[model samples]
Target: RVIEITLTSPMPDFLRLLAQPEMGIFLDGSGAGPMVRSDESDGQPLLLTPLPPEARGFPAREQWQSRARQVAVSAMPANSAVDAFAAGEVDLVLNGRLSNLPLADTGPLTRGTIRLDAALGVFGLVVRSDDGFLAEPLNRQALSLAVDRSNLLQPFNVGGWQSTSWIVPRELANGAAAQGERWPNLSFEQRRDIARQRVAAWERAEGEELVLRIGLPDGPGSDTLFTQLAGNFTQVGITAVRAGLREGAELELHDRLARFYSPRWFLNQFHCRLELGLCSEEADDLVEQSIVESDAQLKAQFLATAHNQLIDSEIFIPLGAPVRWSLVRGNITGFEENRWGLHPLFPLSQPPT
Candidate 1:
C-alpha cells in the first residue's frame, strides 16, 4: 500500500519531530517509508513517506491509516515529553538532556532504552579578562587547573563523557588535535600543585586572600557544577563564592553547541574586541587572520594557533562536553550516534523488509 504521511512544525518543533521515529522521517538513512511527495512548511520542509513494514502490526495502526502512516507530533517541553515517552504515549524522546533521564531507569523504564550523544559542544568557565587581579593569565591558569573536569558530569548519572582542556572539542576539529595538540597536558595532580603555589604567591604579593565569585544560570546543572567547582577551588586556596545568575560576574560557566563545523563560531565567542570585554590582542589577531585566509590548510593553521593561544591564556576553562540522551522504543531502527550531536530523523524507522 502506498502511504503518504506529512508531519511538520516550526523550526524547533519540526527538528524535534523529525528526530522521532513516529514521524517516519530519518536524516541519515532513507526512511523506512518511501517518500512520495513533500510540502514545505513555514519552517523546515515536511517529508511524506510510506509506513514501515514492521509497523503493520502496531496497536495504534488503525489510528494512523487515515493518512497512510500519519503520526501526530505535538510540541512538548522536556519534562512532559519524557513522561509521555515513558508512559508509551510517545515512541521516542528526541534531543533530551541527560540530566532529565534519571527517571528513565525507574520502574517501568530502564537505562538500556536510553541513547546518549556527547555533542561537540563544551561546558566551561568564562573569566573576565579585564577583571582585576583575577585577570592575570597565571592566576587564570591556576584557577582553571584547580577545577576537576570529571566532576562536571557527576550529577547526570551517565558515563562516557570526556573532560576537555581546550575551548573547542577535538571532534569539531575533525580529529586534528586527537594526538594531544589541543589539550593543556597537565595532570590533575600537577595542576593542583601549581594552583596551590600560584594562589599562595598571588595572595602573598597582593597581601590578601584570593577570593572570587562564580556566576551561573539558574538550573539544576548550574547548581551541581557550582558546588563541584567551589570545592575544587577551595583545595587550591581560592575562595569561590556562588554569585547566582549575576551578569558580568568575574567568572561564569557556559555551554556552547556548534551548529556546524566552523571555528569562527567558537572563536568569535571569546574575541576580546567583542562586547564581552574579554580580549586578547594576539588571539584576536589570529582570529582575524584565520577568517581572511584564503587557503584551506593555512586557514586551519591560523585557527589552530588562535585556539592554542586562548588555551594558554586560560580565559575559558574547558570542563566537559555536553551530553544528550534519547529514549527509543519499538522495532524502529536507523539511529546512529554522531559526533555533531545530530540525530537524523530520516534514518529512523522500521527495518527494511
Candidate 2:
C-alpha cells in the first residue's frame, strides 16, 4: 500500500512537481480531501493536504489540524493544533517555526526536535537612489555604518546573530565561504562609523540632506525594530521615514529606488533577490558572471566582489538574520535537517510501528 501524506502550504509549482506519478507520493490538503464527519476515526491510509496561503490568518492549531492525521505543533506559537497534539488527538506534530520544547518530556506523545538552519531569513534596510542624496558609494556606506545590528537584535533575543556576508546564507552555497567568517574584524560600532564617514564625504562632494525611506514588513516586531533603527539613523543626522508594509511594494517598483535598496534582499522565505531596482552597470556585469562562471574560485570571487560593491555603495543596510526551526516525531525516520530548514517528506516508505 502507498504511504499517504499531507502537506500544509499553498500548492506551489515545486510541490505540484513532487506529486507527479514518478514521485510516487500522494499529497493533498484538508480542502481537497473528503469531509470528515467525526473527530476520530480508525487510522486509515489517506493523503491529507497542507495549509493554504489564505489560511495563514487562521490560528496555527486550526491550520495544523486541517492538514495532518496527527498534529505535532512544535515551536510555533501555542494554538489549538498544539493543544490537540498535547492531548494525543493527533498522530504526529511538526513544528513549523523555532521549536519551543517543553522542559518536561510528555512521554511518547512528545517527539524530538532539531535546529535545521542557523540562519533562515534576513531583514535589512534599502535606500531610494531617486532621492538624490544617496548617489555616491560613500553616502550608502555611511548609512550602513549607522546601523547597530547588535542593538537591533537585542529585543528579539538574538544578539549573537551577526550580519551576513553573501546574498544568500552560507549553507546554500555549493563551495562558498560561510557568511560569518568573511569579516570577523568589523565590529557593529565600527561598521556604523564607516557608514557615517562615507556619508560625510558624500556631503562634501554634493551637499544634500541624507533623507531615507525605510520599508518594513507588517508583521509582529517589524515596527518595533524599525523604530529602534530610526534612532540609530538620527544619531548620524540621517533623516529616515519608517515606511511599513503599506509602502514596501511601491518602494520596490520605483526604478530610482535602487540607490537605497540592496540587491541581496530577502523578500520572503523562498524569494531572495540581489538587486531591487538599483541598477549598477558594474554590479550587473559581475552578477551575470557569477551566475554562469563554472569555476568555483572564480565564481566565489565574482560573488564576493558583488557583495563588497553593494556594501561599499551602502545600497542596503544589513539587519539581523531570521531563525526557523522544525520538529519531528521520534518514530519518524529519514527526516534529515537541511540548510533551508526543510525536510523531505515524499520518500515516506514506512510508517511508525
Candidate 3:
C-alpha cells in the first residue's frame, strides 16, 4: 500500500529516508521497485514532486514533471504552514523552528502531534589558541564574564537559564547543579574592572596590545551582538576587530572565534579533538576508553574527566543551553518528548478512529 506523506518543506534527510530499502517506496519514473502505484507500468511506486515557487522555469522542474506526481511546494512563511495544515491541504508538515505557540484542546487536526529534539547544532565561541593574550586562563575567564546571555535569548524565547557547560546537558552523567549556579556573581561593570586589571598587568609584562578578532556572520542580530560584545571588550582594554564573514565560509585557525551546533556524537568527537588536538594518540585512546567502558559509573567518570579537562583549558566558551518546543495536531499518537528534544517519525502513526 502506498502511504501518501506530505511535507511542508523538503529536507535532505527525509528525501534520503524515502530511498531506503525498509521504506519500500520508489520514485515514479523509476520502474519496478519495492513499492508500487496504480499508474505505473510495473509494480512500482509513485514519487510525487512539489514544484516550489523557486523552481519556476527551472530545468529541474521539467525533470520532476516527467518523472513524478506534481504538487505545489510553495514556501509557507513560518506560521502560515499551520494554516495550510488546518485547511487539510497537506497530510504531513515538517517544521524545524517552532516558537511557543499554544495548541487548542481539541480540533480537526486531532491525530498528529509535535516532537521536539535537539537539532544537531551547537552555538559557542572559539578563541585562537595562538593568540598569546588569549593563552592566559585569566584572560579567557574575563572574556567569558563579559557576555550577557539573558539578552541573547530574548529573540528566540529560549536558553536563558544559564551559560553552557563543557558537558552536554543530556549526556552529563552526574546529577549536576543548574548551570546558572556554578559561576561567580559579578556585575558587568565589575567584571570589566576585573578584566581590565588583569589585562593591564599582562600588558605590563608582555608590552603588547591585546587585540582580538571577533568573526561574526553578517546579519542584523549578529551585528547587534557583535557591537555589544565589542563594547564590553573595549571597556576592559581589549581591542576587538569585528570581521564579518559570508555564511558557511571556511575559517582559518587564526580567525577570530566562531560557534555552531552539531550532532551529539559529532560534538563529543569535536570536544575530544579540540582538547587532544584531533587524531592524536591521547585523544584516540580517551575516546576509545569512554565508549568501551562497560560500567556506567566508570564511563560517566571518564566522560566527566574529559569534560573538566576541556573546560579548564578553555577550548570553547559555552554560551547557553537550548530550549526547544514543537506543535502538533490533537490526534497525533506515539510522539514522545525526550531530554534532547528530538522526535523521530518512525514511532509515530496516525491515531485510530
The weakest ten consecutive residues by lDDT in model 2 span 252-261
Please, what are the lDDT tens digits per residue for candidate 2 over residues 1-353? 34565754222344544533345433462222222223434553344334433453444453444334422223334344455555655434443332232311233443343333444454465554535555555555566567665566565553246555444455543233353643468876676677677666656766776666666644345556656777888877776776754464222211111111122222111112444534445655675676567676776677566655544555555554544444344566556654344444432323443
Judge candidate 1 at residue 84 and give its lDDT.
84
Candidate 3 off by > 4 Å: 1-121, 155-162, 170-180, 184-191, 245-285, 322-353
lDDT per model, in order? Answer: 0.67, 0.48, 0.48
Candidate 1: 10-residue stretch with minimal lDDT = 7-16
Clashes of each: 11, 27, 16
Which structure among the candidates has the greatest TM-score?
A: 1
Of 1 and 3, the candidate ranking higher by lDDT: 1
Q: Summarize candidate 1's per-residue lDDT along 1-353 as a digit string, tens digits.
A: 36565533112234543444456644565445443335556644355455543453445444443334432345567667768877788776777654344545555776777878867676677776445566678878887778777666677666788887777766555334545533357677888999899889878888998788888765455566677888999999988877764465788766655554566567777876665535567978987887667777787788788877777777787777766777877555777666566665445533433
Model 1 compared with the native: what TM-score? 0.69
Reference-based TM-score, model 3: 0.53
The residue ranges of model 1 lying beyond 4 angstroms of the native Cα positions read 1-68, 75-77, 98-107, 150-157, 171-178, 181-186, 204-209, 243-248, 262-265, 272-277, 331-334, 344-353
